[model samples]
Target: MSVKEVPEEYLSGYAEILAEVGRTGRRLTRDEVEGRRALGEQAAESGHGLRALVIRHLAATRVAWPRTTSPESVLAAVEQAIDAFAGGYERAQRLAVRKEEAARREFIDDLLYGRSDPGRLAQRAERFGLRLAHAHAVAVAAGPEPYDDTHPVTRSVEAALLSRFGDRRILLTTKDGRLICVVPADQEEVVRYFAKQAHAATDGGRAAIGRPHPGAGGVVRSYEEALNALDLADRIGLDDPVLHAADLLVFPVLARDREAMADLVDSALGPLQQARGGAQPLLDTLHAYFDAGCVAAQAARTLRLSVRALTYRLERIHRLTGSDPTDPQHRYMLQTAAIGARLLDWPAKEL
Candidate 1:
């Protein structure tokens, strides 16, 4: 190979080693092997191709071998040197990879948690293909089991996402045992696709996408929204595999005033404690009733009760609470209270 293809100095001392081994028939010393290995590591870290380095080392060995030397001993020395060199090269590459991963993880944590200065974070984000100035939306998925970057399910979702998007501005990672994807707000489909892939991979687990928000802090806001959506889904017993925070915004508003919500829950539903079955069955009945859109027949079907039985329960609720669930005006109060109860995990949670 020409000196231009492989650096001339790369072969400088290598040939000397081969010539010495050929002349004396003595095995290369530990220092000699270590020196070549260190050279390999330096070459790798400097972006030199391994293929070129190997070819150059082999060719130098050929030209440096003495005319009368025993081929067996020289060949053994060549094998040992090349093996040591390659081992060093590989070690250097692995170390670089680990460092890169660590940097990327730190950047992600800072970006999502708003721990870094906005200007500095925006500059750092560019290295990872994120433009923090643009609006971004975050989607989070939570499964029955906690997940990490190396999990098979996490890898599968990542592969699926890359296959579709070709590693664009979208970012995927795992945080607090959940999978998260952040994408530019304009690319709504990316976050949706992430949610779909995550839900399928997580085995009936739920995914939530937060509405798009702008700037560095917006990402944190969006991430928190997605997380809250997932939590709210669990508290309310929502069955949908995918949820959007936009649709459920009201729950947060109602829950913001904890004292008022607690009062509402007690005033609207507390009287059910006087019933024979206590509040749970009636609470469930109201849940079914509201979920069924005030359709008695549908609610009865959901509760596995006949319409007459369901009506009697509603009547009993009216008598205890003095609010008829079937009344349009009373329905809103009762429904809101039921939601508040679930959000506060009342009764069972002593809210």
Candidate 2:
């Protein structure tokens, strides 16, 4: 049947049913579907097709009408109206989901950056099903390469965290190049477990967890600490996939006093600044030596240098720096300076 022959009243009734479904945010019910079919029967009696009626009304209401008609053809034109209604409903749901997700991301970002007031944050948190009262720890996860907030790795990490921490108040977001999460505090084991899972899932990414802090403000503190630990892990070449801020407390402590750390770097390793080559090799050798517990043989093997060559370099460091690597007190001073160098990115920059 042709759409031009359908009565305007019947077409209006079908449009009303679709509008009702849209308003209620639900799929068409069986009764509604049946009513649509009845409308189609009436249209058929009036010598009109359901598809034409639907197309005209949808155009009138500013909804996109699907072009495919064969699928609904088998069920006749009545099914066409139902298909159009379903498509519109699904589209509306998708749009709603996108809006909600955007709002959620914004809320989390504000909370993490301390941009939201406590009262407003609490109210928003309640609406989002997040409990901010619990002690919380922040964790940062990343792959070897930089990634955006929408990277698959970030999404995978979020899913893994949710699987483990769904019952608790948890928030996940991505910033800069890393995935950040806030989870209930004092669950070091759970944090590590998910870190390992994310590492495997992302084909060898790693995570750093921060110490638990109380209250909403603590979330930012924990985030900062987690970032520090992540940075330190990269600088010191830690092999562990999951690192805890508590394990590396000294770095952050040293980091807090930049001036003092810079001075230490200058005092203990300043002589290396005049080395023929850049200071990095000597610094690497020293780090390897100290990391090997001041054992020449182990450090040499680690650096792929012969013992005599390692000894020569050590002697050169002693000659240039006037600090004996073999002397326990001097070794302590040099090791501390090396740590400071790493923290300050010394020699790479003017320290």
Candidate 3:
């Protein structure tokens, strides 16, 4: 639509996009509004990496405008940008493609580097020749070791989750598929709502989710809390959508998150605390063993026992706690739980 024919809102939207392009060291011409939309329309049509580039362009424009830019200037800019981008595919490629990659790469770089962005982003999707119509984020529910590693089941689970990103605009990749997500902001609400139900249907591994944030930068933020959600899932065996970043910032009462969990383990095994009287031998030994980094010899020494005697005690512990000392995974879990329990108030029901 001509700048004049375009509704003031839409024309302003085009301007907003241009202003964004300008803020990114990319020029925003009055012609780009029409250019970006036409390209957005094209990306919508290309339906792959091309579409991702299109969204990146739109996102960049949105970022530049900042919701405060006058609608007229924004519209005027959008019209100019669209005029250029819509005119041919080359400008869109040179502008949107590289910018998208830059945005994506910048995003991945921040993730790899442990940095947070103010919601601005860059992309690198064209290198893979993948087209993304839209973008959405996902969080994985992961437990300790085996479940945290790479597995075919995890890959399949991600694939399943990707299918549910509304228009199928997700690109699934994870470090270990353990406590991770794609983090596409576009489908945050839907992804948050359906991820649990969807993941429950998947095979292998357990996971939880945090709400998707606004942009590629927000995606990183979302993934940050995904780690916490994952820890909760591992500790509590939570099977429902029990957490979200969108709500978390307001409360930020995460310190108590694990408190409830610690309480759970305490409740489940609290009675044992009194069995050993003034000193709960099992718990004391468990603490020592864990503090000694699970080294049996060190633990035995700490417990002032012969190695064989420590073995016998551990065997009793196995029978009493059902937590296998020989199993590294379970051993660590119980150890962590025990340490967590120390922070809780163990009620005295009279020894």
Q: Which candidate is the best by lDDT?
A: 1
Better of 1 and 2 by lDDT: 1
Give the Å error, residue 115, model 3.
4.9
Which ranking of candidates, highest lDDT first? 1, 2, 3
Per-model TM-score, in order, reads 0.95, 0.71, 0.35
Candidate with maximal TM-score: 1
For 133-165, candidate 3 gives per-residue lDDT tens digits of 233454755533443224664555565665655
Q: Report the lDDT tens digits of candidate 1 across residue range 289-325.
A: 9999999999999999999999999999999999999
1-351: candidate 2 lDDT, tens digit per residue: 454554666654555544444444345566666555565555545545446766655554444222333323323333455564445444545566788889887887887888999778868887765567777888888887776657777777667767766655566667777777777786666667667766786688788898888777888888888898878888867778888898899877878989998999998898886888967889999999998998999999999999999999999999999998889979888998999998888878887
Task: Tell me each candidate's RMSD, in Å, in order.
Answer: 1.7, 10.4, 18.1
**Per-residue lDDT value at 308 in model 2:** 96
Better of 1 and 2 by TM-score: 1
Each candidate's number of clashing pairs is: 0, 0, 46
Q: State, as a TM-score between 0 and 1, how close model 2 is to the true structure.
A: 0.71
Q: Quote the lDDT for 88 in model 3.
A: 46
lDDT of each: 0.90, 0.74, 0.53
For model 3, where is the 10-residue window of minimal lDDT? 1-10
